[model samples]
Target: MESHIAFGYSFQAVGKGSCSTWGTGHFSTFDNYLYDFSGTCNYIFATVCDEITPDFNIQFRRGQNKKITRIIIELGPSVITVENVGIIGMRRMRTSSALKGPVKIVPPKADVGH
Candidate 1:
């Protein structure tokens, strides 16, 4: 499994099903439902509803131009917020053992030659 860090929490993609939206508010649900929405607001795209307490939630914020402006992901005690401003920031839920400082983002190295 490949590990990825978003908003300071490390996770891996172990599931197959996924949801997606693109092109002027077009959306494709996990269950294969397709629709179009052009609202300028924050909306929940996906969330864990199997358990009494949700494990995670994903939301997207649409700007006035009908484009995605921000993405928010809530995983456990961490809330990761990514903006179209070119910087990825993370906010951890306040706790006695919460980590301090900002999370660093390193660009992946470009592959040269085959």
Candidate 2:
């Protein structure tokens, strides 16, 4: 089942076998909770809600692995807040240099009174 929240949406799977996938736009959020007993496959993908303006977040987790990956992509001059990523199996999670700030956006002009 999928649920929509104020800042974003959430998905929960609780059963012996179940799998699902979802996708959303920018300025949107996603929270997923899964409880699998008989082995299931789930996938999700989210993109910028607005074109030429990137502001989105992707959060996912797997019960067996207890792994969660949160990726935040912000565009058009803004600040992003990413936190609360717990330790993973004695190994600390770190961000690589490749992950940087927002990039410039150039929106196309629209024809008016044509």
Candidate 3:
């Protein structure tokens, strides 16, 4: 549950089981921290920002037996301010099928305009 904010965005440590139940509000910030619990949970999603700055570093740690699905970083009605962009994990898959793969970092354009 350790979390912090970087460049006006919040980044927190999310457990494996916690990703499935996360809401859009959880991704309102420009950064996020994900921890893979021994590969128990294999999927993670997030809401992205409208503008992606260079300072946005989306960090992730995969446990022994876990894999990530869709890292949905949604763009909101505001500009995304950051200094770096990154994704740390296994392979990525286009679809979700309970299988293990890399971390899919999605940069979805914000539905609403800022």
Candidate 4:
């Protein structure tokens, strides 16, 4: 079965934090989320990072096989809060190009009548 489970309790942080100590001008973190070519948020990040760059943003790519990942961003802020705590994948990608096409189903032959 596909796992639709979103790991753990979810929370949000909207101020400076531990990572904020990193500087007044340079960092951000996002979990379980990504920015598209149009620079829009299509999904929510599973995790978050403290703001350090005065005013900036965060981006992260999830993996296909990773269930858990711990990040310690030092170049951003000194403050950080871990809500919705749980395992997360980062920057996942396809392993094979052969699996990108349509699939064919085979049918079983009818049993011979006695």
Best by TM-score: 1
* Native-referenced Cα lDDT, model 2: 0.32
Per-residue alpha-carbon lDDT of candidate 3 for residues 9-104, written as tens digits (9 for 90 to 100): 233324411122221222332223443233433332332234355222343323343323223232333232211232323432243233232223
Local accuracy of candidate 1 as per-residue lDDT tens digits, 28-70: 6656688888898788877766647655777777788876777
Ranked by lDDT, the better of candidates 2 and 3 is 2
Model 3, residue 86: what's the lDDT?
29
Task: Summing lDDT over every window of 10 consecutive residues in candidate 3, give the lowest-scoring window.
Answer: 16-25
Q: Candidate 2 on 6-97: residue-level lDDT in tens?
A: 33323222332222332233222234344332222232334345545444323333334332234332323443433334323234565543
lDDT of the candidates, in the order given: 0.57, 0.32, 0.31, 0.24
Taking all chains together, each candidate's TM-score versus the true structure is 0.61, 0.24, 0.20, 0.20
Clashing pairs in 1: none
RMSD of each: 12.8, 13.6, 13.5, 21.6
Best by lDDT: 1
Residues 1-114 of candidate 4: C-alpha lDDT, one tens digit per residue: 111112221222433221110111122222332222222222223232242333222222222332112222222233222212432234333333222121111112324782
* Model 4 TM-score, all chains together: 0.20
Query: What's each prediction's clash count?
Result: 0, 3, 20, 28
